[model samples]
Target: MRITLKCLLMSCSLLIAVDASAQIPTLAKCTRSANLLACVDADGNAYSVNTVGSTIYLRGFEVIGKRYWAQTSSRYGQLTFFTGLASDGEAWVGYSRRVGWTTINRFSSSGGSSAKFTCSRIAGC
Candidate 1:
């Protein structure tokens, strides 16, 4: 009876572990800065980001594809403002078959670059 109970508990624990693992979000690509962390999943379907005070949130309905774009103040609205300074305007993220994926700014015709000057990849930042 004791052995059976132990086996049942172990099995239950294993099942819980598997379920938890399945729910944990996978970080496919990410960019980081002193105040922010922006991550995309393997599916390119969602964005998980950190806002002020170390708060993290997920926004969705995104689809995985060759490229994805995000404009800070514009797309999501006021939420971006509270994230940090310079958290406005158009920001872009893209994926490539050969190079994997990256986040970059679109260059303007007048030599202006819509880039995040201070942010770095999560590995470095």
Candidate 2:
């Protein structure tokens, strides 16, 4: 019984660590420029987002390539949803923002990826 309990605890701890690792880090900082919102994630990834009328334009600078997505926003009460396709039309990206929390989702042939972050504003960029 004792050995079994120890193994179970170890398995639980390993599962918790794996689950935490799968979570994406929040955006570290953000700044506004006119209609554009620029931010950097805790992982040092950079993003530029702009909204004009109902359309949302997102640009991301990743380690390998630059990605651009253009989506439209729909508002339900205080929540706004942005959904659209990538520049090349090979994938789709969606974003939802409520209050100061934002969730981003990307769907592609490989799989779907997601991240959650707090939308924090900083002065002096």
Question: Which candidate achieves the best lDDT against the true structure?
Answer: 2
The prediction achieving the highest TM-score against the true structure is 2
lDDT of 1 by residue, 4-110 (tens): 11111221111111123476745446677765655545654434343444233323223423233232222232122211111223233311111122222222211
* Worst lDDT 10-window in candidate 2: 8-17
Candidate 2 residue pairs that clash: none
RMSD of candidate 2 to true structure, Å: 14.0
Output the lDDT of residue 115, model 1. 26
TM-score of each: 0.25, 0.39
Off by over 4 Å in 2: 1-19, 22-26, 64-89, 93-125
Q: After superposition, how far is residue 17 of candidate 2 from its true place, in Å?
A: 16
Model 2 C-alpha lDDT per residue in residues 3-120, reported as the tens digit of each score: 1111112221111111245565343478888888776655555556676765556555442335444334554665555445444454433344444433222222212434443432
